[model samples]
Target: MIKDKPIFSVKNVCIDFKVGGKNILSKRSVLRALNDITFDLYKGETLAIVGESGCGKSTICRTAMRFHSPTQGEMTFEGKNIHKLKKDELKNYRQKAQMVFQDPFSSLNPLHSIYYHLERPMKLYHNFSKTERIEKMNEYLELVGLVPAKEQGEKYPHELSGGQRQRAYLARVLSVGADIVFADEPTSMLDVSIRLGILNMMNDLKHKLGKSFIYITHDIATARYVSDRIIVLYAGHMVEWGDVNKVIINPRHPYTKLLIAAAADPEREGKVELPIVRNQESEVTVWTPDSKGCPFRLRCPVAKSECAEEFVNAKQVSENQFIRCIHD
Candidate 1:
């Protein structure tokens, strides 16, 4: 279904972290984690945030879920400011927006049985009776392809495989009646053979149950497979964002092009890490954050004097597609 209304709207959101000891704390010790990020998340669509490890991908997810308050700007969920919500309201909002953490093993409670894990949410959120909770838990557990529900229910997390644990994590999200799932590298730790299974399950969850997913990952190939739209982030800034196919086939930003090329290399017989290209001095990686120019000017191959100016408009390359670079 095409959602005319965006489930979540992030407007010029910026986050900062204070470094150094309490005694050493100073105004100069602030580190900008996110710099004026703005985006819209449509209902039931899988939007992938792809970036390198330190590029603020997870920070965006955490901030969107209201795990931390933003230093600047705001995030609206269902037309309400998430940051301003009080205890009761925030708890209610937390139920709607649940997180599937990166490590499946770490996320699941090792001591609790699978049934205990799923049933607790149903009991807490929906207040289902013992009988009803058990029944509903089985339904969701089986929905994620966890067979022999009776036997699996009694088993602890350590008893299950990695894929099984991941499925259990998905089942947990369903148990809470989560409308939006912020899956931060959900399958990054799984075996290569089983990663697709988890991704396929996420796809099925979106299509069948109509759940919106914010998939955060560095693997662009997996992002392309699972996301309807892909956002490319670099050094805490969004360089490119749009349809997955459009961005992959025709990358507009140099950073995006490099990311795509590194993730998927048709020229190579087998997958290999793309060589890192430097900008001028090899000793230091430079960023022109204060310059009135494109954010990617340092690493851009086609850099020019004109590119040293701010990009006010994102060009419409095609329907449902836009790019921020004037050089594009």
Candidate 2:
């Protein structure tokens, strides 16, 4: 297998939202959605971001797509800084990277037909003739397994089932010639049995088409199934990241272990011990520039007094395995 280079690289990327507050002493404050997040997306591989709901998985996806600008750090695409791209350049970059949103029904336009949805991007980016655009639309529909494209294209978003609507979304991405797909909980809203089908399609796309993907989900099992590498995020910081099998079988971080513990094994009939849940908001007293320590220290079961100091950077405990835990 060819070791394809990183098509997208995010270096210490930070995203902060200015939330409103009331108090004479309070200045306009920012909520750090993503804190010093650094990761790379290699070609033809899936890098799954697994975390709880407010850990900023979606923010990372949005930042990479240029939908949300980072407050700090640099994002590079094909070795060029994406944050500095001009309007036309950004538009061209967007054409190559597409997002498959969680809710299939909400992603598509209720008023437009599937054909119109697929045709719009092709028309906007490529200077194809009407006949060429229509032909390409049919080809994309077929590529996403929405065959009999001529008839399916005429149906509206509501006319299709959840899985079908998601397939339509994939067709739109294919229509635009996108090589990287950022799928944010793509199967969360679908029926449990059909979720694997969507994941299998993504796996096929990666192997068959050499397309890269970022699969974001809270489900650890799905991450292991669909991703080559897994990144475990907690409260806006990466706790552990490495090869999927390594992390799943031998989790290092407290949070990662908690997640693995929570997930029940389908092969085993009886229920397993549930993982302990942490209060996200109470995990830390504050994010102080003066403070230096592991971000997960407050919630870590094995925290020592030494953990109160600045936590050390991630260490490679084994080949292809890295965890940002002092205990590890």
Candidate 3:
């Protein structure tokens, strides 16, 4: 995968949202959603962003999709900085990189047909005639396994199941000739049985379509299934990242171990001992820039006083492993 250089790269990206406050001291304060996130997306590779719920997985997705510009650092697409792209350049960039949102129900327009959703992007990106666009729309519908392509395309968002809606949204992404896809927890809202289908489709897209994907999810099992490399995120910071199998088999960071332990394993016998983490907040925006040390220190079982004094950068464990812990 590294032979053909990275198609996209996020260099020390940081995102901060200015939220309203109740007290005078908290007035117009910045909440860091993503902190110094850095990664490279090679062609036809699926990079999974694994994290606990509300750990700002979506924030990374939105930032890469250009929904939220980074407060610091830059996002480079094809070696060109995305944030500096002009209007037309940005439009072209958007055509190449698309987002499959987490909420499939709300991602598509309720008033429009699935065919319309597919056609709009094709119309914008390709200067095809109406008939040609219609043909391509049907092709995309069938491409995502929406059989009886014309029939499925003619139906509205509400007319389809949650899985079908998600497929339709993906088809729309492919319709625009997207080379890089940011799937922000695409299967989180779907039923357990149905999620496998979506994951299979993504794997097929990754290998078959030769598309680079950023698969964000809280499920480590799904992450291992669909992704080539995995980045374990905690409180908006990347605690561990490496080859999927490497990280899954031997999790180094406390947070990564906890996340992997949290997964459902039918084969494992006896009661599992999960991490005894407490005083954890669902929304981790309270973790600030000035707040020293590791974010997981408060809850980490092996954290020391130094973990509270200053932050530690990710330590390289192997050729394909990295972890952000005070220990070796």
TM-score of 3: 0.94
> Which residue pairs show backbone clashes in model 2?
292-310, 293-310, 293-311
Q: Give each model's whole-structure lDDT.
A: 0.82, 0.85, 0.87
164-265 per-residue lDDT for model 1 (tens digits): 999998998999999899999988889999999999999999999989999999899888899999888876777788898998888877778777777755
lDDT of each residue in 1-328, candidate 3, tens digit only: 5437899998998888888787877777677878889989999999999887767899887877778899999999989899889898899899989888889999999999998898888888899999989888888888789989999999999999999999999999989999999998899999999999999999888888898899998889999999999999888888999999999999888878877777889998999997665654522436766666788888787888998776688789988999888887
Clashes in candidate 1: how many? Answer: 0
TM-score to true structure, per model: 0.91, 0.91, 0.94
Model 1: how far residue 309 lies from native, Å:
4.8
Candidate 2, residues 1-328: lDDT per residue as tens digits? 1356789888998787876667777786667777778888888999999988888899898888778898889998888898898898788789988999999989999999999999998888889999999888988788777879999999999989999999999989888888899999999999998898889989988998889999999889999999999999877888899899999999988879878877877786777764443677545434433346766677667778887776668789778889887775
Backbone clashes, each candidate: 0, 3, 0
lDDT of model 3, residue 80:
87
What's the lDDT for candidate 2? 0.85
